[model samples]
Target chain A: NAGVTQTPKFRILKIGQSMTLQCTQDMNHNYMYWYRQDPGMGLKLIYYSVGAGITDKGEVPNGYNVSRSTTEDFPLRLELAAPSQTSVYFCASSYRAGGPDTQYFGPGTRLTVL
Target chain B: DQQVKQNSPSLSVQEGRISILNCDYTNSMFDYFLWYKKYPAEGPTFLISISSIKDKNEDGRFTVFLNKSAKHLSLHIVPSQPGDSAVYFCAATRVFDMRFGAGTRLTVKP
Candidate 1:
């Protein structure tokens, strides 16, 4: 089912530059999330969407923005890139939340902010 | 502050040996726990999971044990193979919030 897919496998950005990390899932999941993983650190939530037109901030959402225009897509935007944002980004989806449901993750995007 | 923690940064074992990875959580209300495996340059994939209601869950060569009293859980891979080498993450979730551990790299040398 293609599961989840992310675009721009790798990218480099200059300070203050902005870009969107695209994520799409064919599983028709109702919940989607964006997370960042730093070296030797666990994945930290950036933002999440419950469904189309419904979004919420996560633990580490300060420097990122997200929009859920449709059920299949949830794009994460970095408004002002900073060196601290250099890390691996992952998009995940699940049929539902707060239960036994498993979250399916994308291949991940490697971003380097210079 | 990190709610979930995997104290071991890495673990090594010989092929066909047992590999045990441990995890501890500070929140006592966590109702579900999960384990994920990740290869270099790839996102994590689900390995196994256990709910608070149960103390142990087993699937094939993998097993997960939860100790509610201690607020700790562990994953055990029996007869580990070289292909099992990867980073393992421990995760815990309550109603809407989920937290992950730093991850433990497992190397099963053949």
Candidate 2:
């Protein structure tokens, strides 16, 4: 099964340009998350969803937005891209929360804002 | 403030040697600790984990030790191989919140 899949592995955006990073998990996970990783930095959560139609902001959710319309898909939107938003984005999913279950991660999308 | 930290930015070990990667956390509420390894151009993958209730957990060549009193934990790899070269990240979770450390890059020489 494709645990998690992300579209547009790499992309370059101009200032104020908007785009969405698509993520899908065939594992039927109830919990989905969007995280960004800067060079020499740890993964920082931008947003997450408990299930379909439920979402919440995370530590670094300021420049990003997410929507969970279905259990298998969670997409992250960058409304106005900025240079600071250049980083590697990752999407992950877990069967449930607060358990021993590990969150499976996707390959990651490299974004550069010019 | 960083909740989890991996002070050493990089580590190098000779083949067949023991590699110990350290991690520390500032939160006392963290009940679960995990280690993840990532290669270039890929997302992090789970390596091993330990719960706060236990001090140590072992799996084959990898072992994780937790010290609740010091808010520290470590991952030890025995007989380290060149294939083990990668960036290792330490993570801690409490209920629904999880935090990760700035990974430590490990270079194993054959």
Report the TM-score of candidate 1, chain A only.
0.98
Error (Å) of candidate 2 at residue B92 is 0.5
TM-score of each: 0.98, 0.98
List runs of model 2 lying over 4 Å from the truth. none
User: What DockQ does each prediction reach against the true complex?
Assistant: 0.77, 0.72
Q: After superposition, how far is residue B101 of candidate 1 from its true place, in Å?
A: 0.2
Q: What is the lDDT of residue B31 in candidate 1?
A: 88
Q: Report lDDT (Cα) of residue A68, candidate 1.
A: 95
Per-residue lDDT tens digits for candidate 2, residues A1-114, read: 988999889999999999999999999999999999999899998998999999998889998888999999999999999999999999999887754578899999999999
Worst 10 residues of 1 chain B by lDDT: B91-100
* Deviation from native of the Cα of residue A73 in model 1, angstroms: 0.3
Cα misplacement distance, residue A36 of candidate 1 (Å) = 0.4
lDDT of 1 at A81: 99
| lDDT values, one for every candidate | 0.94, 0.93
Q: Residues B17-65, candidate 1: write the lDDT tens digits.
A: 9999999999988889999999987889999999999999999999999
